[model samples]
Target: MTDSITISVDAMGGDHAPRAVIHGADLALRERKNIRFIFHGRKEQIDPLLDEFPKLKPASTVRHCEAVIAMDEKPSQALRKGKNVSSMWMAIQAVKDGEADVAISGGNTGALMAMATFCLRPMEGISRPGIAAIWPTLRSDIIVLDMGATIGADARQLVDYAILGSALARSLFDAESPTVGLLNVGTEEVKGLDYIKEAGKILQQASGAGFTYHGFVEGDDIGKGTVDVVVTEGFVGNIALKTAEGTARQVASYLRTALKANWVSMLGAFFASSALNALRRKMDPRTVNGGVFMGLNGIVIKSHGGTDEVGYKSALGLAYEMARSRLIDKIGDTMQRFPVNTAPPELPSDSEAKSA
Candidate 1:
């Protein structure tokens, strides 16, 4: 629906640089007729992969750069010292120059966030950009925000995250009035820390304006489908996400082993084949491969570092949907309506915030 949306991907950002990344670009081209990709990395690294998939020749283009920022490098140091780093710098430049609708990477999380914050900057009224991850719930998906972005946030920042998360749920999932819940240790109003208690009060008072503010939601309520949006600071949200992911994988593994243990169970597995397959599909991380960095001037999707072709393709699919949805403009307009009360905390002075 968008005017042939172009996505710029960091071809060498992940652990399986060039190969997996190029395969992903090829997959996106083959599947989406209107989408184009600008692969940023070394030509030597990507040329062979492109040669293997000739259909990618016309639909995609590559911008060659020499340097590479390693996975372990500190984000601030990388941004300053690695000026010519192919994936890092090119991805930023492409978005800034209006050459791409979105930029995606499966590289270092800190570096990617740092690059995005510097290159695109936050929207006019956004204090700091937040990351939103879609978690599977019983009834529907829950959109949780500030997932490792702003670690220790104030009451006002939490409220801002709630607004941003609520808008995302409304826009992306078409929830008329999304239920917003604050993640806390207990469901009681006065159970959480001082900051959380204060945030809950503010959210409860402002309920009728935007979303349905459900007082408190504990860790047990995450996948129970109790709330549509869960608002928490980055530290807790990240831990929650990682825990959910690990638990899902462990459950699947245990099921598989148990089913193959005995002849009786093997027979049961046959009868439940379709049901098990459905469950596996629902739980597959590849199906939900893209995570959006909200409150930014441009659309940015972060893929998993260990993603294969399937995950890569899914990211591109997400990018296409986000572009068609006009999410950037929608988010900008939303920020204009409900702005952050306080400005973001300033970055350390010695750290130079480079664009790419």
Candidate 2:
């Protein structure tokens, strides 16, 4: 690891491309003085933005790329059309070529995942890569994995997710032995599908693993911070993630409606404005914007496409922290430490597998 870290940016990926991306990088650079950037996008658009932030110019280098991947474009189509020419591909290629420590994009999630996997490749011994998200909880935050990277994980893959999520918790939270849990229908050992139960057994017996397995965690346990890391297959993880996001918004909406219901309520809200602001900050999705692609050879972060500079800055901050902590190396070490003796044989339901 070096004192200075270089990050590759897909400047034209988001809805507010080039401008928001560049501004966000500048914001991140202001906080992390040791960070540098390699911006991949059109010269005409990126040059003007770079000129706006004088401090960012010296710390950044722009690589001209003509193509852009559409948010709605299919992964296969994006890869075929924009492999070498798109800004997203160039950003990821920087990581592969060792020009950057980490790569980030606020683009199409599927496209970014496809390009990253194609360019950087998965880590050694990893059959499928997982996307890990930093999830907010009552106590603080927990790391959740397979947020939509690949679907239908077998017992072995579920165990792999446990390793990946625990590494992330270690890197971000600095937990020496993070408590991990498998997301299931019930906390009982006999609950959940066969693969889930098998994974539970493997995790239960994993002695030298970097994390402590806390048995099965139900969906409610996620928000309560029952464990430091939550592991699940993409099918369930994605649904859980979206449901949480939606529920957050729903709660905020309800609060706003209640606050404005009557003059007395409005007065009460005004009186508690400071506390309300704090609550709003805690609930903001932008505060935890990055979705990290774990089990990959290089670090790649995906930000929300519609997010503003604040959200993008949060993503960049995550990238800086992951790179500074040597997240890939930590994950590699943890993967090696994972016990592989309890892997279950093939199951029938896991036949129709899909990568996200």
Candidate 3:
């Protein structure tokens, strides 16, 4: 933690490109000063932006990369066209090259994941990596994982996600032992898919895994802050994420329509304008903006490509915290403690067979 933590920034990956990304890095430095940036993108596009932030310029290094991955490009196409030359690929490569502690990209989700997996690979003993996100809840923020990194996790993969999510919660919340839950259809004992139930059993039996198992939680419990970490497969996790996002926008739209309905309503809205503004800020998805690809050898945080400076800044802050936490090592050091029942039965070794 003493040494300056280097964060590789994909300066040209987002809709706003070097502008929003550099502005975000500058704003983030206000909150955290120990960060050193290695920005990957066209020097012509990035240098001008860095010059505006004199404080950040001295603390940053820029690496020129001519190619940029388009938002519409498929992961395969992105890799094929850019390889290690794209801004996104080069930024992720910094992590694998040991030049950066972590990489942050406001780029195509599939491409970022693809490049990250190709460059850094997964940590030893990890079959597939999961993406963990910070979710705002009624009581406190919670952590949810496998938000479309890899879909259809088996019992063991689900359990690995729980471990990764728990470590994240601890890093963010400073919780000594965060409570973990399996997201399910219902809270009843016999309510979920076999894999979920099996993962729950494994979590229950894993005393050394360093988290409190809170058992099954329904979708309703997510916003209620029922647990510090919620574990689910990517398919369900991604659906829940989109549903929450859409619900947020729907509620906001409904409120706006109500406020402008009539003279009396408009007057009421005017009087309560301050409170409404605070509510707006709270509900803004930009406040919680990073999806961390966990269970990898190094951290890779995916920022919303369409977000503005505020949202990108949040992502940078998240990357800083994760790098400070050394999350990869923590997850790697603890993963061996929990093994799921769904793991295929092991075959006897030749020596054991002969002895038998």
Candidate 4:
């Protein structure tokens, strides 16, 4: 626990791998001068990149691991074969061993989750983990989760998401008490799946605990900042995140086409160049690159596997911020005040399971 923050990085984890990881670390150093890096990957791959970043050289060190988790590897396969040997696992181990404040990887999401869950384990009372990501919005940004950590979350798990997400919002936004909501088809109590309704009931009763709980918010509310934190099961949350990302790209494509449609439009675009630049900044996916793993003992920031240096840098920046904010301690403190119920959701009857 030095004054300077140490971030453990999975240097061999992305599509563009050690190169992007190294470059991103260098970029992050410019933003935070008091950060150090513990890079885990092949020495041959990382050593050459150090030559390119003289400033980063002194603040960084390498731990070589021969295995690199493949992007498409199954979670089970990764755990069984590469668990302790892979760069991804070693990076997470650094966090568990108190060598780093945070871990960042542009690796297989499923594999990372598997390794992280095993190595770091869940926080004391957290039954399941949720992958939380920042959603850019008109007002500012919102945190959305269970971004595919598990396929579905039960009522209690959903409440855990609200508490966990609120902790994240408080840390990221620096708000003393942040708002939270449950994503549903409608605002009505009668709508949505049974579990979501159950979660809402619990959240409403727990509002004064630490957050302002908005009863129900639809998909459209996500972009309106209706709530600082939006909670949902992993399957739907993942789909929503992908849809939003796709929509942003589609909108950017449309703008590009419209601006070049004619001479008059092109002239209009020239006049609106500054505004367009602002719009581009708003829509850039790289700006919101990392997905924070909630309910874990330590912080792990998951970068998109295919992202470039810009996106990787954003992920590293996010990791640095979470570490600086003491996000894990905040989450633990919040959970202590708002203790999560340990009861598991009721399993469907044998007949019911067979019928579907």
Which sequence of candidate numbers ranks them by lDDT, best first? 2, 4, 3, 1
- Where in model 2 is the C-alpha error above 4 Å? 341-356
The lowest-lDDT stretch of 10 consecutive residues in candidate 2 is 347-356
Q: What is the lDDT of candidate 1?
A: 0.81
Write one digit per residue (lDDT tens) for candidate 2, span 64-146: 99999999999999999999999999999999989999999999999999999998888877778999999999998999889
TM-score of each: 0.90, 0.95, 0.93, 0.95
User: Which residue runs does candidate 3 get wrong by more than 4 Å?
Assistant: 336-356
Q: How many residue pairs clash per model? A: 0, 0, 0, 0
Better of 1 and 3 by TM-score: 3
Colliding pairs, model 2: none
lDDT tens per residue, model 1, 1-356: 34798888888887887788888877877777888889888988888788898888677788887877788888898778655565776886787788988889888888888888888888766677889997878888889888897789888778778877887787778776689999999997768898888778767766755578998999988899789999999999999999999998999999999999999999999999999999988888988887888887787888888889888888878887777677776565444544223434322123332422
The lDDT values for all models are: 0.81, 0.91, 0.87, 0.89
RMSD of 3: 3.5
Model 3, global lDDT: 0.87
| The candidate that achieves the highest lDDT relative to the unseen native structure | 2
